[model samples]
Target chain A: MDRSGTMLFADLLGRAKTRIMADWSAELERANARVPGRVSTQELVAQGREVLELLQSAASSGDSDPTSAAYSRLRDLLAEMSRARAFQGFSPTETATFVFSLKKPVFDAFRTEPDLSPDAMSAGLWTATTLIDGLGLFTMEVFQKSREEVIIRQQREISELSTPVVKLWDGVLALPLIGTLDSERTQVVMENLLQSIVDHTAEIAIIDITGVPTVDTLVAQHLLKTVAAARLMGADCIISGIRPQIAQTMVHLGVELNVVSKATLADALALALQRIGRRVVSASPAPAVRASA
Target chain B: MDRIPILKMGHALLVTIQVDMHDQLAMALEEDLTARIAATGARGVLIDISSLEIVDSFIGRMLDSIAAVSRLLDARTVVVGMRPAVAITLVELGLSMPGVNTALNVERGLALIGVSVSGDGEHDAGTEV
Candidate 1:
């Protein structure tokens, strides 16, 4: 608490930076954090140095609490590092190791301070332990959040990709749904199909659900909602690809798809063509060979 | 008090809702549509909502009511050109407007109502209720 003690702590921290950097990098390598190719050793060392410099200044200022305003710069650095690691596909352990590996080098620095009493040495080591542990945990928390954001964004992209509305004919469109019909996905499916319907001036839309894995009550409801939305846009909807199992499930659930449905995409397309006064006729069979028999 | 104009095309009445329909305006449109349907003995009513970006449950109910009224008068109603966003919102709101018929555009809607786009009587007979 005295001026000399504070000055000595600052001097020790200044001397500890290089040792910590070297030891931390070696510790990370020992921990195999560099194996993932997510971050290069040089990049990791640079980041570690910046964090250590900030930590030394804050710690010497008597700001031991990681969550305090004094540690804001250190927190930002750790958060940025964690987010980068998360997006780069590093494991949470590896991300946290970036912070935890600093503990050994810091404690070594405290041990080299021979002028300090035994009690002061332990206290300094404890402060470093607490700060390092807090920083490590903060990195994990940020990693989790960033990973979650990545997952949610990927889910959105997948949902958008799964619902593709293809124009089967001038006035007909086909939407082949290939996944579970959750409420969010259903919203995407309906919006995409309906937008295509309006754009194509499609008279009929065939929603093929063969790629859909199951037909629960909720999924059926979402399908019906899509159908209704399509119909509202002045497009008749034909739900195709209702496998026998799905049909059975629908029957057992007593879910009536009030709209017309076909068992196959080809059947739905054929019917759609027929409704629009068009039909695909097979080309005349190859001229029969009179002497074949 | 803006009134939605109802244009007569052959034996069908076309109402293009280009403005945002409030409660009163929706009710008035419903009344006017029913009265016109009864007086003109219109065989089909086509309501175009392509320009409408939002259709809450209230407007959704109005569409249903209009369809029901037209059906009772022996006239078919086809709602056409509903925007995708509006349709999605309506479905999310759990108002599907089951009683109303929908078409992709006015041309197809007229065909559904038994009137040809070229004003021909070829498909008109099939549309009679």
Candidate 2:
């Protein structure tokens, strides 16, 4: 019974390797179909080596490949992918597309490999899932670290940057700020604030803070600079509704906002009115008025 | 349904608006205030935003319109006591009334209008010039 069990295990490993090689060859054929011209022999050889190493790793890790032919084929196919990656010059979109191209075949073969022992099939899926997860993690890291990457690539995609301008006050300009203000956002803030200060001669600028989660040092610096800049342009800038945690962070960080008068948006407007010499004594209510019929 | 009136404070017209004011409210308020401005020739207008949770595009637009209309009427409009998140959202969303005034609280709003908050409900006028 033990001898039969060992033989069964050997049979399962052989079948799993065969399935992997077959799927890999199919991928190579499809890629070749897309780019039939100028795929140098050297590129093929190099890519072939990558596949070889992967198969070798499988063999060494106790994947009982019969006669090593399956391992050889896998080696050759990986070489092709590596060459394609190199030819594409590692552009993320191109690279992602290439990798994405192979995803289905890999998944399908992995899913349909009935010859694989249940354990072997599960292990293959686990390996593929982990690899895919790692790739996603890597992409996210790239996005954070390389601002230029996103800026250059997604310049047209950021619809928020060029959103329509809606003026809300006679001489009182309201700028609602949401999202975490990064340096990039700071530039956006600077442009909008300065332009509005000049264009409308904004007597008071209300910057409300309902969406920001946390105020970091950089963000604090940006806010301070905007306030200072607004004042320089002869505009009274009010930083309103500072959250509790943000206040604590601002204080602890020693980022002094002494230059800009701080108040709730309401207080800021009141102050703005006072600057303009207007006062409201009664709650005389809205004139029970209706829109023009 | 002119439920609210524009209050004449010291130097500015104090208009206590509905916490959730609308374009219709804005229009009525504008007409009433417009009449008052024509009647008294006030120089500034203050719309209190104390009881608001959120301020959307319509309301933000109305505020801008109110301010613009006030400017045409020669009364500078002010919005006071807007919450932090609301303000930030307006900016991020790029909503604006380029020259409206905003305050954190009523006292500051009152102070903006050159009104000294005297004891009880009395407001003494400060140096106006």
Q: Could you tell me how far off, in angstroms, the CA of residue A174 lies in candidate 2 after the best superposition? A: 1.7
What's model 1's lDDT at B43? Answer: 90
Error of 2 at A121 (Å): 31
- RMSD values for the candidates in order, in angstroms, are 3.9, 19.9
Q: How displaced is residue A50 in candidate 1, in Å?
A: 3.6
> lDDT at A131 for candidate 1?
73
Measured by lDDT, the strongest candidate is 1
Which parts of model 1 have CA positions greater than 4 angstroms off? Answer: A1-9, A16-22, A33-43, A286-293, B1-6, B18-35, B53-58, B115-129
Candidate 2 structure quality by residue, lDDT tens digits, A176-249:
77777776776666677666654665656767665567877777777866664554333566677787778888
* Per-residue alpha-carbon lDDT of candidate 1 for residues A7-77, written as tens digits (9 for 90 to 100): 45556778766776788878867776547565677777787778878887877777667898988988998
The segments of candidate 2 whose C-alpha lies over 4 angstroms from its true place after superposition are A1-166, A260-263, A280-293, B1-129
